[model samples]
Target: MRRHILPPVTRPILLLFALAALAGCGPTAEPAKAAADEHGAAVDEFERGPHRGRLLRSGDFSVEVSIFEEGVPPEFHVYAYRKDKPVNPRELTLTMELTRLDGRVDRFSFAPQGEFLRGAGEVREPHSFDVKVRALEGGRAHQWAYAAYEGRTTITSEAARAGGVTVETAGSIVMAELVDMAGRIEITPEGQADVRAWYPGRVMALNAELGQTVRKGQVLARVESSHSLQTYSIPAPLSGVVIAKNSNVGDVAGGEALFVIADPTKLHAEFFVYPRDAERVRAGQRVEVRTLSGDNRVVAPVEAIVPTADIASQTLMAHVHLPPGASATFRPGMGVEGSFQVAAWPTALAVRTKALQRFRDFTVVFARVGNTYEVRMLELGRQTPEWTEVLGGLEPGTQYVTDGAFLIRADIEKSGASHDH
Candidate 1:
């Protein structure tokens, strides 16, 4: 405002001050610094430190951490390097805190080995955890924290519901160790009959058709004796369905079967047990008979173990007697599946077979605690078609995902939350 012209030195100083004021009014420097602070230690994805482990650097010294499991328990090995040169193993004391996905934390101390430091305790699978490594260097501690992801994931309850995930609790179950075998629906000896021609016949009139229901003593056909030329009646021996018609009208009938009848309601299941299973199977054992459709199942007790074995298949026969009301849906000669309960025991912990998922090299089931799902490694025992006994790794009363577990696995895999080293 003073119409007076300033000196060159004063003008340059004023211009400098104006530029500084504009710079101060611009974006604050705090955001950039905050971002840098938030991402504390950077992960060198492309560069692995010595010992082929993850490298964490402080000043010119770097610590390489890896899990080594050769001829020893799984343990962490830490190697210290300075400017690509090996640092004295005695110079650093390493400790690690592994926080697992199940909210459990395991702490490990490392002592100096020949050339590096090794963790004192074992590291349990599946190796997915939030790992914090602290090295005591020159009486001062340097820390690095990162996540070692394995088979793990987290999903909200609403999301799981929308994804069709269902949960079931792990609990005690009586699982029968079953032996699978091929079987067929057969007619009991008393329930089957072969209607024969009473005399040699030159001509006959057939009255029964295949699959026809007939009453006991019902005339199935009329046969004429060749010697006397007299007609005789061929009656059904049992009240049941005619399964086989051996004679046609005007055909010669000898002393052979004219009709075969079987009572469907008196069916039995006959299973062929191989030598491997024959010793375990015995009379009075429980057997479940299922049709090829798999929708029908009948529980019956084993009636007998036939002494004869099949010459070609080398399998022994086991007979299961179906009760009168139990064979309504079964018919003779129908192919069936027999699951013999060879062994049975009460398990303290068991889960649905559908709940199991293969994660890494171990079998895992997703257990739901609150809104989060954590992977549970399973040590399996006897397994049935519907249930699997859990020998260890899962506790009773733990709620596990039974359906859509693979969907959760897919979600975790898609999120890239997987274990790497």
Candidate 2:
């Protein structure tokens, strides 16, 4: 994915990546203290504390809170100050509530740890949420609430469709395990013809030239039998191009091959399979053949597998006969690539690998509910280049972004939302 964070002035912000960007927490809000609280709100520039955490200030009393997650599960760390001087952490009773996008609230209580107060519960990943803080100092109570958002953005459905944003339902998919090999196109044995005279004779008149296209029974040469002293016409054996000419006029034609004809339309691709993979390759298996540049492609079944291995390379050859229609682009001796489907594994739930995006420390995809989308952190299992098994996190039939997901992420980032504490 392109990391180039496009500037918002260009209207680069798109809602397609709606949920995949929810890793940051931003802004303070809701003046009345919420008994229970959660794009996301924007703050000009959050005030920072000496510890580099978001600062919650109110006159002579303030609390600077940070998520301490260096080598342990994320936990909240808070430092309190009174009249611009350090205050005893033990003298204050601190508590907080984090309201997530789905209306789930996680509550925490704090205990003093040296100079900082450590919260009891883990903050969890993708710190994006709305947080409320309540601190009891002597006879006074200070309450603060704010909204934090990252990796979350929204745009109208019409705009999303116009921008070419596409989505797909996450469901069961059979993963194809492919064995890729390199080979070259070749003329099948039945497609080639080695011409010879019917009897011992001398080439009286060799008519066919190298590369001449000839049809079956077309007279290619006239030979004079050594014994009969009579001329006999040697017609073509097949309809194809004359690729090799062993004898011409006035040359002996009986003892050697007169010509070699090859039909380009009857061709096959031969792929070398090493011993480890040779056992898995069998006749009747489908194989995808493509030119080295991948401009042309064809799917054909394996027609044969050589019983013998190459003496030098110790590799068996798998032959896939190309269809007659592929002759236009598939030529003998042209290097090609073969992707043989060797095995397959089915999983109940899976998502397009391309749809997955980076969200903080987890792999996530945006889930859509009506016109809105949000992130779902996934627990991945087996994987293939095209699809990945979803063991946990995403639900069956959830809609996910397939194409233009990065554009969404770029738009959200352009909003200056930071999920990092």
- The candidate maximizing lDDT is 2
Clashing pairs in 1: 149-418, 149-419, 150-419
lDDT string, candidate 1, 1-421, tens digits: 1122222110010000000111111121111111111222212232366577766666566678888988986888888987778988899888889887567899999889988898899888767677777777776556766666655556666667666778988899788888888899889998999988888886567888899999998888888898899998877887999888777787888867878898889878988888988789999999888998887888999999999989999998898999887676787789999888888888888998878898767799987767656678888988888899898888788889988787767655544444545
- Kindly give the stretch of ten consecutive residues in candidate 2 with the minimal lDDT sum: 17-26
Off by over 4 Å in 1: 1-164, 197-207, 217-235, 248-254, 292-296, 323-331, 358-362, 379-387, 413-421
RMSD (Å) per prediction: 16.5, 8.4
lDDT of 1: 0.74
The local distance difference test score of each candidate is 0.74, 0.78
Per-residue error (Å), model 2, residue 379 = 2.5
Please list the residue runs of candidate 2 whose C-alpha ends up more than 4 Å from where it truly belongs after superposition.
1-9, 12-41, 44-150, 155-169, 367-373, 395-399, 416-421
Query: Model 2, 308: alpha-carbon shift in Å?
Result: 1.5
